[model samples]
Target: MNILHLSAVNNWGGGENQIELLCREFKEHYPEVKNQILCKKGKLFHKRLEKTNLKFLTASLAFQMDPRYIRRIISICKKENIDLIHIHDSTALSLAIIADNLADLPPMVFSKKTSFPIRNRKQSLYKYNHPKLKKIFCVSKKTRNVTSEGIQDENKLVTLYHGIDPELQRNLKPGLDLRNFLKIPSERKIIGNIANHIEAKDLQTLVKTANQLINRENRKDFHFVQIGGFEKPRTSSLLQEVKQFGLEEHFSFLGFRENAAALIPQFDISIITSESEGLPQFIYESFFHKIPVISTGVGGISEIITHKINGLLAQAHDHKKLCENILILAENEELIPKFAEISHQMVLQNFTSEIMMEKTLIEYKKILHERL
Candidate 1:
């Protein structure tokens, strides 16, 4: 089968990462399954695709809609004789919806990566675009619910969780090299948060949590390390909050690093304070590295973590609860092994890349059979 996968950005965020992983494994598993990527030309991720056999097609379908871009996609589909077109983002969906309407156009599928509001104003887009789609793959139960409610065909909406390579989670080398590289003091008990510095992430909670640790005795034993960048305006506010709370010495922000699994193993615990999320790969990555997690009760997090089991969960935007959980983990070394065991089992049982590929291939074959 020939597949055309579409995405709008070049940034290596969660959705892009998911598409890349799928493309890589699909090519490996089915050598006969030729694949092409449709994305903005000359973006940062283009450089990262050098070694892959997948070909890329650049078109004008800007991240948002452009009528001319829809014409371009339809032309490419006809010229390339693509068997199926899989669009990966909301903007791409609009263009693909139109492109699929032309004569001899290929089957189209869409992956829903985010949860939609119950009364989403974007429902009109879904109503118009979803009918043209052969199937909709949602990243979590929440995503599935939103798509099912938006589209007329409940059968077309399927839940396929995000998967990661088991090997990527292995810490082949100790993180001491990274520690020395960052000049992190060797004696402090490190707690790491690996996410971008965005408003949704509520990073100031981490900074304030560090300050809370400082007021207690044995304060020198604990410290905070984060892996993310702040290009947006709110980063300035987060920086000011950290400074105002007197947490400069205890907190370190190690701007976006790819070697997260290696770095995570060195920390005592991993924390996530997101206001919302789908099933995040970070938790699985931490599980692979055998670290415990402290996260908020959001999205599909409960699907993986049982409170006081695999990881601890806090209420959204509750900085005090976040501080309380961090202190609990810091004081009790015994809980670490139990948490790690449960987490590792969770990854092994449900989130492997192999399982995701198997399920995806089945979906493709099922759709093909129905059309035949």
Candidate 2:
């Protein structure tokens, strides 16, 4: 089957990672399944695709409503004879909505990777409820629940958790030991967060949590190391907050590293302070590396974190609760490896790339058959 996967997002985040994984496995599982990726040129996503053999087209999105951009997508779809178009971001979906009105487009499926609710508006309705969009694959049940409420056809929405290949980042020797590079004392414990400086990531609560940890006499030794790139304005604001909280020494912001995955082994524990997520990619990667995850219980996170079972959960934006969870895991050293094992086994059994690709192919086939 011919499939066209499209993502207009310039940054390479969890959704892009999932798309790349899907493309890689699509090639391996069905060599005959023709796949194409259309993404922005000179972006992180394009850089990741340079080594892959998957067919891809690159373009820049000056504006979302640009008819030229829509034409570019339609032209590629026509040339590739794409049977179906899988949209990964809202920008692509929006353009597809406009493009569909101007041309006879192929069936489209959108992957809703975030748990944010869709606005009940004409624009949201056109992008989601349009006739061309055949399916809405949500990364978490929470995302599906929130998204289905705004849409007319609840049957079009499906929960498909994001998965990872356990061995994908194995054997890559990172040139930099993050702890050593950061000049953090060898004996101090490290709490690592791998997310960009976005509002949804909720770094404000993370800063507050760090302050709370420092206030605890025994928890002062723990260092929170985050590796993410952000715009200067956001960075400045975050730095200002850290200074205000007197957490300058306790918090370390290691701006965007391409090989951030390689540094997970250095962390004592992995934490995600996001207010919303469609089951974050970092959690799966951290679990694969045998690092126990502590995250805010929001969106699809509850589905993956079984409350003190595989991993621990804190209420979103509740830094006090987050600090409490952190102390529980750190103080009880025995629970670290135990939690890691449970999470690792969980991902291996249910959230692996192999399982994701298999299920996706089944969906693709089922959709095509129904259309026929």
Candidate 3:
């Protein structure tokens, strides 16, 4: 079967990682199943695709309804004999739906990776519940639940947790020394977060909590490191927030480090304060490194953290509780290893790339068999 994967996002993030991981695994295990990607030209995904052998086509899509891009998809579908279309992001989903309308295309599936509820209003609803969309692969149960509100056919939504390559991160050597470079003292406890600067990440809460911990509590023993690229046009806003909150001494923004995963082991504790999420890739990577997580109990995070069992959790936007949880993890040395051990084993058992690829292939076969 020939599958055409579509992604329109310019930034490289978890969704892009999912595409690369899935396609690579699928190719290795199922060489008979041909896969191709249609991505935005000159974008991060397109650049990364060059590193892989997977066939890809790119266009500078002006918007979701760009007629030229629709025609391009139609052309690719005919040339590649694409049997299935897997839409990976919002713009790509919209483009695929439009392309389907323009031509009698193959069955399409959409991957829902965000836990933010789709606005149940008419147009947004149509985008999600379009007739051409055969299935919606959700990364988390919370994402499925939120998407179900905008979807009429409940059976279409399937919760398939995003899986990481267990072997890829295992035995990863420390690629870089972030601590010494930043001039942070060895005695200072390091708290780390890996997320692209986005609204849903709610990094303001992290800054507020840092302010409370550093300034209000007079806890100068902790250093925070955030590693990710800034969202376009919103880069300096975060710095402004840090300045206003008086967290400059405590917080360090490491912009778009290529070896961010390698440095996770250097952190004393890992944290996430996302207002909304499907399931973050950092948590899984941290699991492989045996780094304890302290995240806001949002999205499918609870499914992993288990509130002080495997890792600690706090409510989103609640700076007080986030601070409390961070301190508890920082101060309790015995609890760290226990939490890290359980979390690490959880990912190894349930969330490996092999398991995810095999299960997803089964679903694809089921859908294609029914269609054929």
Candidate 1: residue 254 Cα off by (Å):
2.4
- Tens-place lDDT digits, model 1, residues 247-348: 777777777665455677778889998877776777878887788999987877877889998889998878778888877887787898999998888888
Give residue 82's error in model 2 in angstroms: 0.7
What TM-scores do the predictions have?
Answer: 0.89, 0.97, 0.96
Residue 346 of model 2, lDDT score: 90
TM-score of 3: 0.96
Which pairs of residues collide in candidate 2? none
lDDT of 1 at 176: 53
lDDT of 2: 0.86
Off by over 4 Å in 2: 216-218
Q: How do all the candidates rank in terms of TM-score, highest first?
A: 2, 3, 1
lDDT of each: 0.74, 0.86, 0.86
Lowest-sum lDDT 10-residue window in model 3 = 167-176
